[model samples]
Target: MTDATSRDGTRSGSTAQPVGGAKGPDELRRQIEQTRGELGDTVEELAGKADVKGRAKARAADLKDRAGAMTVHLRGSAGHTVRGGAGRADPPSRRARHAVRAGLGHPRAVLVAGAAAGVAVAASLARRHRHGPC
Candidate 1:
């Protein structure tokens, strides 16, 4: 018995060594503060070169272009609906009717025209569905 000896007679010194180059709480706090100061300086340097105003101007221009495109798209859509209604109200010219009838009278031509019209209608519906409400 010494106080360092366990009940089984193992000594503390047999498995323990003095810690060297270990930082205490105050030293760790100081290192953290120094790192934070360096990070702040780096952030300031980056901010100086960021061109925030220029980026904002570019974003505004992009939004303006999109709005213009939307206006054009809406106008075209309205025009198309108006024209479609007009076409439904009034039948085609006699010459056009005769031409279509002549084309439809041929089996191969009729198939080709039907396929083309189907593809066109499918494409139009697909675009309308993709855009939503327009």
Candidate 2:
């Protein structure tokens, strides 16, 4: 018979115990506000998950972080050879060996990349020859 309930003991069909069963209009309003806040949070979370561009951006950020971590690990492991420590600098042959080992992990991609780089260099040189030095 109250504003929050009827003869069926239902208040907005939310729950049997409305506002934690408090007997006041203020308690009912508080419960409604709480429910609205919770629903808003859920809606925002669902919208974020449903956004394709947002999800892709999140995925890309995660992958970039992972790649940066891997780079750090690799740099630490190869620091001496790659960075050439003072007074104990690695020779060019040793450096070339390290580079070769790194590239050998993906031979096909390495070949394709090398071919592309070669073509780019050739094109640049031909341009310079045709247009003189820039």
Error of 1 at 7 (Å): 46
Global CA lDDT computed for model 1:
0.78
Which stretch of 10 consecutive residues in model 2 shows the poorest summed lDDT? 11-20
How would you encode candidate 1's per-residue C-alpha lDDT over 68-125 as one tens digit per residue?
9999999999889979887554346866888878987797988888999999999999
Candidate 2's C-alpha lDDT?
0.84
Tell me, by TM-score, which candidate is best.
2
TM-score of each: 0.30, 0.47
Candidate 1: where is the Cα deviation over 4 Å?
Answer: 1-49, 87-134
TM-score of model 2 vs. true structure: 0.47
RMSD for each of the candidates: 18.5, 8.1
Clash list (residue pairs), candidate 1 = none
